[model samples]
Target: MNYSKLLFLFLICVLQSCTSQTKINGVSFVAAGIPVTDKHVNPVVQVNANYATVMPFGFIKDLKHPEIIHNTDRQWFGESREGVKQYANSLEAKGIRIMIKPQIWVWRGEFTGYIKMETEDDWKKLEATYSSFILEYADLAQEINADIFCIGTELEQFVANRPEYWNALILEIKKIYKGKLTYAANWDEFKRTPFWSQLDYIGVDAYFPVSDSKTPTVEECLLGWEVHKPIIKEVSDKHKKPILFTEYGYRSVDYAGKEPWKSERSMNIVNLEAQNNTTKALFETFWKEDWFAGGFIWKWFIEHDTVGGENDSQFTPQNKPVEMIIKSHFEEQK
Candidate 1:
């Protein structure tokens, strides 16, 4: 090849390589957001990059379930903490800043078999439960040197009535925990939430249905994102704050035409398919949106029997196709 042609090709390759890579603290990050290469410059160095939240690092443990809590306390606590530590270690080792999300919520049954806070007493109990949970989780985050911490997840009814309580909670948390703080409000209620001013960033659990049908095509689902974009922009504009999707996912099962919302029915074929399709649609649409900082799937894992149910199945993220899709997506984003 001619000398000019060879040099032109070399320049093109260098540009492409640079475009596809980001380096922090000497560690190389690929497009997918995950660090593919790292050198031990110092873990704390990477913790400074201004990136969206770094997670799927967070999960909910049913404190009401003795067995679940026991297992988590005995094995998962250290293991999960260490796993996050390694993640932070890798990213920070490269000088990348990560936001850690540790969410506390009352499980489906723990709050009178519903996701809402129905009464004043219910709100009080939930507030207390969350307060204690945050204390424990905050300590864990500190141990792992997490960069940010979410104090609560979607408990809208409670938040609406107890705005002062949340302000108080944030104050108390600040006294103990030293990192960015936020609460994950449901997408519909995020605007009505009175506590956004107290948080470092507005965190939301945005799983608005992109399509009404059980099995919408990927293109149809992506189109639905158009509907949500304005809502996201409005929130960001009004609040004048960056947003994060703290919990977001769809079931892979089809609940289109089944009794008792078939997708919630255990061992029911209709529900299983609906769940799967919903899962597929969610991933397709999420990647298309640019307003979001980033979000964690509804969950990481759940107990075996805890899979089927109305709100339950939608929140469980373990062993699903969505998980693999996320891993691939983030890898590419890196």
Candidate 2:
């Protein structure tokens, strides 16, 4: 071969190698009262998603409350023990991996991060109850042979104030569930999480604030990521673990990336382009990086065809312009 041709081939190979991504394209399947069926699983498969996070919730009255109530009448059928197994089996049969994520829902939509006890007695009580809540699901995760088991989700104060407790909890959980483990730290809380070293992957619910633009452009959001990418990378490097976005997505609304964490329920204009661009920027920034493992989009409903449309500006990409953008990225294997 000529020297010029050899050099051109070398450059092409380098470009492809740089762009390759080991992404675990995933969606957080929202729990429903009705059972999960092939109808529901088909959409996920169509997206070329290989992983799905199935969350069953336990509730608490407030941040200071010690008791975590679970498996009650108020819970949805899909969040129940029987529902989770069926969902796992159905999805796994179609060659999708499952991540059983047990999360705590504070009553009235209070933040789970602020859960702190006023007294040592109350703390102990909370510990015992929280442990029970997690362990019960841990056993369920093992039974289903889940690919990943998320021990907790966005409980920042609980982890910070009780490192020893979290350490012990990890040990206890390992004894029961022999699967990959992670804790879903809030986007901002993952840095201080003391136990990332003990787990398989450093999981973050990556709702990073990428831009303040009312209708942010993809290039603008990429600049926004330039700020957070290094800081998040620091954590991954320190612990020598890949970073998995346990939850990450933007709503199809104005200022979607300004505070990516907010649930915009009040009347807001739907900007399908804004959601598409912001989500595109995320894939551009993290997917190709070797240190960043992959992430699950914030939510996807069971009623796939009926869910989010042009008129709606929720986190879900369903039936929106962003859906196509996400699908294109997911379909691109590695």
Candidate 3:
């Protein structure tokens, strides 16, 4: 009567329903210049993304400078701190877990990873200024009861060089924000940081290259992940901390899988299939791992509604096929 087969099928259905809601299904809400509208919030909730990460930027002119280049007195330049607190409140009202991730926007430099100070005095000044920037957000995160607070994002070399400074800063942040904390490290730089034990989760930006092929299938992308997963699990095990892919996504462009970490806009190629494939590969590969805490996909925007459709290519998977894949994956956890 094939009772064994029937039992297996029934168990599959039960498992599917059991994992339908995620522990931390998340997406990065691009709240920089955009207003947090119901239109945007609705879609994010629709995707079943319960976790929302909002980034506010603080700038720096050079590594040696003591001043952090932010215009608003106690707020980030473009996205004011008041604005972010409001957004976090709104997101929480809709039953979303929030992460306030403050990123460094280098004024005349390539990226934050390039920030390195030669002298201890310079490093101390940099730490002092950066600490002020982080503490402001920490106060807000505590005020709003944010689910997670990332102390810094992608200040790779600077953090690697001054572990003592970062450890002290984490201690200070702990004094303010009571929520879980993490630092978003570049994929290649997570292993180099010595302060993983100080934070709640090991946050990796997860832009690791999947495949070089312009049109790799979902299977090929999974193959790439297979190589990376063991290394990630090893780190998580060593640190006794679960890992979170703080930012992970693919641009809807040909060969986006080749260098998933590159933030630069490539040629005007809109390969929706490629983006979808990447989405499937990542979620299917990582979602069920015990040490894998879940991820926040690269971005979702509140403005430029027409920018990320079938004919356009960008990381915002808002109006594209990739979104459905995200929704389905997130839904599976419900």
Candidate 4:
């Protein structure tokens, strides 16, 4: 080829590489009692969301208990294996991609991160039980052609105490699931996770406290990200993996940015403006970045009409002013 022709091809290659990355404008699609149909899933498409996470949950009695409960009679429709398959099919039909995310919930809102055993034998038992829960879903993920399979979520101390178990678990999961892999590390714990290199994306439940002000302005929230953005980027750089916010959002309440991770019921005033500005700050700061792989908003219910309103002080941007902001940004990303 002539020099000018070769140069033209080189520029085309660079541009394609730069524009090929898809911003994963996603929602943590909440499980509901009834089977999800096209009606339940259309809003995700309406918002221009190309991705949605299907999170099946495992539960233990408490932080110390090794025995885990999953796919049992007490669970909701979307938490069972068949439910996941149904939900995933509906999403796929709509042309939305899937991320089968299996997370563990400790009883009584106990943090999964604090789970540790009193003895090695018990730890072994816990690992065995947890592996069954995850691996079963891994098979389903592969069967459903999920785009990604999350190995775990926010299990900090478990990972810290048993990194070897986690490494083995990842290999086992990769053996069964034929797709990308990620772990939803808590914001404070992602830096210490030892297995980012084994996964396709560096996943963080990035509820970083960005601002402390009551109903802080967008500029204030943006300033808060300045402190954290570089730190998060450094980890992605070290791992040579794009950063994916497995879960990231702000509650529609006063001081929403102060403790973005906390979800306990609060009597604080509902500040729609705070949630709107804080959420917009997130999209503005991270959505355009080349290294940031994009994010799933913390929560989105299947039913759109009655979920969130001005009076509700919840994490969901559903039906609120912030919803439009999310829609606009997602539209642009597509």
> Which has the greatest TM-score?
4
For candidate 3, the lDDT comes to: 0.83
lDDT of each: 0.52, 0.91, 0.83, 0.92
Model 3 C-alpha lDDT per residue in residues 76-138, reported as the tens digit of each score: 323668778877877888888899999877766567888887778887888778888899999
Candidate 1 lDDT over residue span 34-98, tens digit each = 23234322311222223323332222344322111211433333234444455555555554555
- Ranking the candidates on TM-score from highest down gives 4, 2, 3, 1
Query: Compared with the true structure, what per-residue lDDT tens digits does model 4 show for residues 1-334?
Result: 8999999999999999878887999999988777998889999999899999998988899999999999987899898888889999999999999999988888898989999999999999999999999999999999999999999999999999998999999999988988999999999999999999999999999999999999889999999999999999999999999999999999999999998988888635899999999998988899888999998998999888889888889988998899899999898887
Please estimate how well model 4 matches the true structure, expressed as its whole-model Cα lDDT: 0.92
Which candidate do you rate higher for lDDT, 2 or 4? 4
* CA displacement after TM-score superposition, residue 126 of candidate 3 (Å): 0.8
TM-score of each: 0.59, 0.93, 0.89, 0.96
Q: Candidates 2 and 4: which is better by TM-score?
A: 4
For the record, the alpha-carbon RMSD of candidate 4 to the native fold, in angstroms, is 1.9
